[model samples]
Target: MTARRADRAGRALAQGLALALALAVVSPACAAEADPANDYPTEARADYVFACMAANGQTREALHKCACSQDVLATILPYDKYVEAETVLSMRQGVGLTANVFRNAARFDDVVADLRRAQAEAEIRCF
Candidate 1:
């Protein structure tokens, strides 16, 4: 179970990174001037929230969403890789992911890193 959880966590992190990169590349169809990834900060927040959810055992959907044969933890790592892993799992709206995932020092750091990267991508490509 530990191994499986670690594998799942690794997968979730990769998907989050991929999602970040993809979101960065693909501008929204509706807006030409506005950056899709930063239009509302939802993606960054969602990234953190979903990761928190996965870590806290709130949901396992991210396991399915982030399926990969190879371990992808390093490729998708932020400071709070574990918390981000948890956050990326449960992701829901009208609730909170930052609050759920930010119970640790490392987790909070990872959120900041992830948010910064996402924000940068939004500015460089989307904007």
Candidate 2:
């Protein structure tokens, strides 16, 4: 009977340790999810870094600077605003009446301006 009691205690300890380990693994992820300011998805950040590296050069220093730049921009601009600016810029690059609307619209210009301001801030902070 003593041996059986010892085995049950050991099993209980093991279960407690397993629960602790699971909490340790999940807590940081939960904290990150709760952070509202860091709403940019990993893929968006990666895409920005890749484009920045392409434009600035593919060196390790460029990679660091680009990542920093993206972080700064994330702080300065929300992901939805970033998407809006990118869409405007993309539409402006096309050769048609629709592109002209994007190019000439004041709201579109404001969106691009916000992105440019964010980029400028990022450049100052990161590069």
> Which prediction has the highest lDDT against the true structure?
2
C-alpha lDDT (0 to 100) for residue 2 of candidate 2: 100
Model 1 Cα lDDT, one tens digit per residue, 1-127: 6999999999999999999988877755444345322233335445644654565446455443332201123223433443454455334222565655454457456565675564344334322
- The TM-scores, one per candidate, come to 0.23, 0.78
Candidate number achieving the greatest TM-score relative to the actual structure: 2
Please, what are the lDDT tens digits per residue for candidate 2 over residues 40-107?
88889999999999999999999999999998998889889999999999999999899999988998
Residue 113 lDDT, candidate 2, scale 0-100: 99
Which window of 10 residues has the lowest lDDT sum in candidate 1?
66-75
> What lDDT score belongs to each candidate, Candidate 1 first?
0.48, 0.93
Residue 29, candidate 2: how far off, in angstroms? 6.7
